[model samples]
Target: MPAERVCAVIPAAGRGTRLGLGIPKIMVEIADGVTVWHVLHERLRPLVEHIHVVMSPEGEGPFRALAAGRIESGAVSVSVQGRPTGMGGAIFGAAPHWDAHGTILVVWGDQAGLSPVTAGRVVEAHEKGLTIPLVPMPDPYVEYELDDDGTLLRVRQSREGDECRPGGLSDVGVFCLSTEGLHEAWTRYLDEAAPGARTGEVNFLPFLPYLSRERGWPLTVVPVTDPDEARGVNTADDLAFARRAHQRWAR
Candidate 1:
C-alpha cells in the first residue's frame, strides 16, 4: 500500500468525568495555549495523509472551529459519535470515511505526551505487521502478556496476586493496524463478545487476545522507552503531569 494512503483515527468521544473538566478532555489546554487535540494533530499531520477525528456531538462545533484550517485543506475530517459506544464504536464510525485498503494509526485523543517521533516509529514498525506500543509500568498493574518473541498473548487487567508479573509492560492505547486486521477484529468482537463486556463498552483490547490465540495473528510489541510519552490525560493529576511533560518535550 502507498504511504500516502495511511490514515489516522483518533477516538476523542469520551467525556472525561475523572478530569472534572467541563469541556472535552482533548479541548483542555495543555501547553503553549493550545489544546491537547491540537498538539496531537500537529504531531500526526506529517506522518499520515489524512486524519479522522471522532468526537462527541456536543464537541463538534468547537473541534471544527479549532481544526478549521486542516478541514478546509481536506487533510482532516470529523465525525460525531452520537451515542456513547466506546472506542470500538468510535473507530468503526470513522471507518467509512477512511480508505479500507489502507493502514490506520489509532491514537487516543487525550494522549498529550505523544510526540511525532514516537508516532513515526509506530508507522515504521507497522510495516512489519500489526504493532502496539507498550510502556514499562513502575508497578504491576494491568498489562499485556507477551510471548518469548514479543508477540502479545493477552491483556491482563489485574496482577493482584498470582496474576502479578513484576515490571510488566502496559498497553498505551497506540496501535498500528492494517484495514484487514481492524475489520477482522471488529467482526470477531461483535460475534464473540458476551453481554455487558467492559460495561457495555466495545473495547478493542479484548480482541487482541482473541485474534492472537484463536487466529494465530502475530502482534508485534514495540517498547516505548518513556512511559510518560504514552500517558493519556484522564484525571486531574494526569492532566498536570501531561502539561509538565509537554513543556519538557517542547524544550
Candidate 2:
C-alpha cells in the first residue's frame, strides 16, 4: 500500500492561565532554550509531511518567531484562532490551511514528552482508521470507558468534572484522525452538542466516541508502554515535573 499521507495539527491557543505562565504554554521553556514547540516539532518532523500550529491571535507572533526557520522552509505553518474556543475549535480553525482529505495527526501542544517512536505507532495504527494512544494512569485526566470486547463506549473528562472510574485508560494526547467526511461530522457535532458544563467549551475528546459509535468509524486504541509519555505540562508543577523527568530521560 502507498504510504499514508499524513499531516499534523497542534492546538496551542491556550493562554496557560492554570500554569500561571505569562506566555502560552507551548512556548514555556522545558530545556535550555527548548520549548514544547521545539520538542513536539522535532518528534513529529520525521513522521509528518507538514505541521500546522493553531495559535491564539496574540500567540501567533511569538510562535512564528520561535519557528522562523521552519516557517521560511515551509515545513511549519501557523493559523490563529480568534477566540478561546477549546481544542475542537482550535483544530477546526486550522481546517482551511491544510489538506482536508489526508489523515490528521492531532497532538496537544503541551505534550512535550511525546517520543518519535510512539508517534510512529500512531501513524502506523492509522491503517486501522481513527487511532488513539492510550496509557494506564492512576488518576486519569481523561478516561476511556470500554466494553468487554474493548470497544470504546465513552470518554470521561476528569478535568471537566466528569466522574471517571478508578485506574482508567487515559489518552496520551495523540490521535490519528481519518479525515474523510470530517467537516460534516464536525458540523453535525456542533449542532448536536453543548459546551462542557465545567469548562464551558466545545471539547474534542468526546468526538472520538461520537465517530466510533455514532458515525460507525473504526476506532483503534494503541496501548502505550510508558505512562510517562502521557505527561502534559498544564501547570507550574507539571512544568517542574517535566523538567526533572526530561533531565532523567536525557541521561
Best by TM-score: 2
lDDT values, one for every candidate? 0.78, 0.85
Q: What is the Cα-based lDDT of residue 205 in candidate 1?
A: 67
TM-score for each prediction?
Answer: 0.90, 0.95
- TM-score of the candidate numbered 1? 0.90
- Model 2, position 85, has a per-residue lDDT of 82
Off by over 4 Å in 1: 158-165, 195-198
Candidate 1: 10-residue stretch with minimal lDDT: 156-165
Instruction: Go through the candidates in order and give the clash count of each.
Output: 0, 0
What is the lDDT for 45 in model 1?
81
> Could you give the C-alpha RMSD of every candidate to the true structure, in order shown?
2.6, 1.5
The number of the candidate with the highest lDDT is 2
Question: Model 2 residue 103 lDDT?
Answer: 85
